[model samples]
Target: MIKIITKVTLAVLLLAVSVSKAQNFQGQAFYKSKTNMDGSLKIESSSMTEEMKQKFMESMKKEFEKEYILTFNKSESVYEEEQKLDAPEPSAGGMMIKMENSNDGKIYKNIKDKVSITEEEFFGKEFLITDSLSTYQWKIEGESKKIGEYTCYKATYTIPVSEKEKEEYANFKNKQTDSKTQFLMMDEPKEQLISVWYTPEIPISNGPGEYWGLPGLILEASFDKTVVLCSKLILNPKDKLIIKVPKTGKKVTKSEYESLVQKQMELMNSQRGDGKDGIRIEVHR
Candidate 1:
């Protein structure tokens, strides 16, 4: 009995040491994130041919094809974009269409303390948005897939769409009654089902962007018209990285930050009120 007890104690010590080593190291993950435009783009220009329009759409698609890096330890993570060379500016005829993508900000999450902070820059000003970490009710499915060397399991959640946005999209689609305009109507749902693939081999309850709280590290996520896939992962490199909280912007709650952004967008729209000058404020979720 004493020999068996000694063996069990030694095994437990070895397990503890391995877990400590695994949790203390830092890791980096590369992701390619692409989000499609919510509604079909309608550009009414007599100077543009169908081929020109197609080229313009391709350019627009390239705009959203972005790369991001997620640097993480056991309890905290920082997710930000990887900068690339700028493409030539797209030329639009007859009108200036202005839009905003709120997802360009940097996000930091600390799962140990249940806290999150995002540094957002808008029109030259930066704001720090502080809030609680997001809690997702992810339903794990029996399905499995492989992303690189790790096998990932499927999980999903849902995001409900608002009625006002639905009405606005419907109106935009039906406004093609004019003789000079052509509109393409599409069927959009009231809720978007978000899916993710996670691997328990890298056992950290974190992921890229505003997603986390799984039993493992999320390797890929799909939602709305966007898909964020992990292209590469490096664990425990030669040089260690510092994972710290963000603290460079005006501090505010998440709701307060969103309200301020809405007001600023409204002011900009009113200032640029012109028939040919169109301003559209888009906040991607």
Candidate 2:
């Protein structure tokens, strides 16, 4: 009897190890992202015609509505946008949407290392931004909801707007066109609070790009007129995924990269110089 009991205990231990090895290391989460265009669209426009607004929203749709895949493990994760062939961008009165990040942009984070690296393109130049992980002072609220099969809880953090962001947004208004009407679409963003729903079932403190340190896997996140929600969860696929850290690009710290980008924007803004002819839109993502 003693020999049989010992064998049973050892077998159970082996089975537990096998289960952990199979389901706990790495997985993929698919997310659907969309911008809250309603705020901009609802801004009362006395001078801009409805036709102008429609054309502008149509052009902005492609840039804002997107799909992304996040592949994560115990401590490291990679987040990247999924690319699709897009139709030719529409334009209205020389006004158009321009994205600063390249289609190949990717963000990788290592929670154990407390670091993040981003691969992005700016003005035909590729950049690898390396920085310490930005932490959020998350306040867990007593709110819970069902996301898929898991129960998700809400947590939030708020960061003040940067002076540079404020200055750029202040300049984002329509120029005096030859038409009789004029309007301003953007409002200075205030109290930039972010909310995320996380589930403890996954037990990975990871989420979409730049969002981490949650108690569980973040299922949905929203901030600054944009929302990203996990649409599918695939845990422990047949083939193991390798989380490869990005190695290509000009290496620079996050602050250094932002400075370079600001310099380029200054040059462009000087050239743009309050043009007196058509609509102007400056959107930062």
- Highest lDDT against the true fold, candidate: 2
- Candidate 1 collision pairs: none
lDDT of each: 0.77, 0.79
Clashing pairs in 2: 47-182
**Residue lDDT tens for model 1, 207-278:** 989999998999999986789999999999888988878888899998798678656644554454332433
Per-candidate RMSD vs. true structure? 5.0, 5.1
In candidate 2 the C-alpha lDDT for residue 263 amounts to: 70
Q: What is the lDDT of residue 55 in candidate 1?
A: 60
Off by over 4 Å in 2: 1-24, 39-53, 86-90, 93-96, 101-104, 161-189, 274-278, 282-285
Superposed by TM-score, candidate 1 places the C-alpha of residue 282 at a distance from the truth, in angstroms, of 9.3
Model 2 per-residue lDDT tens digits across residues 1-285: 999999999999999997787446689999999886653543223345778767766776667888999999988999999877977665644566666643437999999999999998999788999999998999999899999899999999989878877876665433323323232334566778899999998888999879999879999999877899999999988998999999989999987987887677555544545444434553433
* Superposition error at 55 for model 2 (Å): 2.5
lDDT of 1 at 144: 99
